[model samples]
Target: MSNGNNRQVIRAEIKYPILAIVVLAAIFAFTSFALGYDQGQLFSIVVGDRAYEENFLHELFHDTRHALGFPCH
Candidate 1:
């Protein structure tokens, strides 16, 4: 006589890929901003050959930029 209960479960493995995507996106965003690209200026930088006079992130986050001493002016 024997009584047994056995069950096997497998969980999907997707967290790693999702995390990688998020990290890459964050890096891209930070690099873009740090290099003076934000809002729609990324397009300009890619399409044109000259540096931009304004940064949309700086303009949009003017108060924050000044508070952080970013020297937007």
Candidate 2:
């Protein structure tokens, strides 16, 4: 009877996932800051008093914004 299970979580497995999460979080934060509804004006363009698309970043990354659960119209 031998109970010698030498299974350990590899550093790469842990690190890579954490790294990816951190990178994604940073990107999401940046995008939110740059194009969120509250502050979208900084990265948006207005025309003729009223424009169809106010947020350029949202329009440019429409699909991604939706996928990331960011409101965009």
Best by lDDT: 1
Model 1 clashing residue pairs (backbone): none
Tell me the tens digit of each residue's lDDT in model 1 across 25-73: 9999887476443544665666553324554544666676567665565
15-51 per-residue lDDT for model 2 (tens digits)? 4678888999998987676655433455335443234
**Superposed Cα deviation of residue 36, candidate 2 (Å):** 4.8
Model 1, stretches more than 4 Å misplaced?
Answer: 1-40, 43-55
Query: For candidate 1, what is the TM-score?
Result: 0.34
| Top TM-score model | 2
Off by over 4 Å in 2: 1-28, 35-40, 44-54
